[model samples]
Target: MGEAGFESRFVAASDGLKLHVRVYGQPRAGRLPLVCLAGLSRNAADFDVVARDISATRQVIAPDYRGRGLSDWDPDWQRYALPVELQDVLTVTAALGIERAVFLGTSRGGLLTMAMAAVRPTMLAGAILNDIGPVVEATGLVRIKDYLGKLPAPETMEAAVALLKTIGAGKFPGLAEADWRRQAEGMWTMRDGRLAAAFDPALAKTLEQVDLDAPLPTLWPQFDALAGVPVMVIRGEHSDILSAETVAAMAARRADLDVLDVPGQGHAPLLADARSIGRIAAFADRCDAA
Candidate 1:
């Protein structure tokens, strides 16, 4: 457990791999837990700011999915599939004694949120889909694949930040140097005095199975299952992955869905900013009251 108020704990997956989860704040009776799920190749650190900000109101749980952060890596990379990841989530929730939670899922994590809704709708009090939807644009996916695991480890933190800037230049326009440094730190770790990506390289292999030439699979059914639950969706204004058209369709289907399109961002917005965090907190409070 971390001494910084938050508790760092591990739960064993069915296959015996240990998955790490950081618990923030004390549990309040009748208040729904908030779980922040990171994007592909990202981990619990991605939620540091938002989790800390909202922990005062309700318990916050951030998990380092298998092969990311302190979690045990799967020898079989294929196990990185969504079904296995979903089970891992279930195991963590069960171990934590949480019957229901309001989930904040980013990118790939958002897809997992939809999957969970389909398989276990009762487990979700609400969900915030950050920069993701039923349909994924091939262009964004192709862009991600272009460098997913191809970048070499940086020799210094400065180099890591530079690399990130070069790669993420126009995507997150107006992000300050400090924000980029924070992002670099979150995505990579210093090991042997060099910076390396925080996730297993095999994680990128999962993307190889995607057929960019063909249409990507839609998760409308999984999304439809969330109709009973309060839901919020956040989109990066310039995101290539979650298009405006898809968000419109989602809103058309669920009139109650709350939507936020963050300006000057792309693919995914790092929910660390004040405005985004405040909006999410408000949505969560509403869910808790409902």
Candidate 2:
């Protein structure tokens, strides 16, 4: 509810696919920017709480990847992977005329940040990784796949609330029933009186090929790209996505690295909450200071 406006635009990627984006901030003639990137299945609006709280001094840009939110669905759903999304982020930066910007990345967005750091290190000011690490837990990935595209469409708001209660019960704890209901409406869209997932259903296809036994690819090269840049990583104490041991390992290598662990959360900590929000803002302020 700040003075931020949601203006939608499109930036054409090298592959000629148009990626949708939303901007939140006042027009600044000369000022460095701050960008927010959402989780795998989330859209730009996922940053609404964070952006609205910081728009006074930072130009916040949020993008909906090829297969999510208002963006066009890829003809080849396999292109929904991280490699393609990284290219799309570069295209977005080029379109915005931003030389460098601080990244407030959540989940998949955090992985994309590491990829960018490896592929194009010069474009980033710094990065705050929210509940994601180079290594991921197979258990969480498997749990996510179980409901990838199997959730039933809710016919009414009440039905949507009920669906969220049943599905999100274990996922997001410590939230009231009303909070879960609000989150459900935000994640879906109303289509012909039924509440449907806002993202393209084809995105679920990526989960079908996930191999849990194999070790996930190492992203050290990507993390190396952030060598001289300020980096902060936030993890949920109960998160399966980023284990505390891995985070400690990352910190050992980089003495300047900052780490935070949110209690009573798992997989990913909701950044919109006040406790995490303040930490993220402080990280950005440190980036500016440097």
Best by lDDT: 1
> Model 1: clashing residue pairs?
none
lDDT of 1 by residue, 1-290 (tens): 35566789999999999999999998898789999898888999888889998998899999999999889999999999889998998999999999899999999899889988989888898999999999989999999998998998888889999999999978998798988998898889866676788888999999998889988888898899898899999999989999999999999999999999899888789888899999999999998988
Model 1: residues with Cα > 4 Å off, grouped in runs:
1-5
- TM-score for candidate 2, please give it: 0.92
Residue 215 shift from truth in candidate 2, angstroms: 2.7
Candidate 1 weakest lDDT stretch, 10 residues? 1-10
What is the lDDT for 139 in model 2?
76
lDDT of each: 0.91, 0.81
**TM-scores for all predictions:** 0.97, 0.92
Clashes of each: 0, 1
State the lDDT of candidate 2 residue by residue for 1-290, as single tens digits: 23436678898888888789988875454445778888888888777777777776778888999978878889999999999998888889889887788887888999998877888888888998888877777777887888877788878878878887786667567767656665676678876676789888999989889887787776677777788789999998778778888898889889999898887667667667787878777877787777
RMSD of 2: 2.1
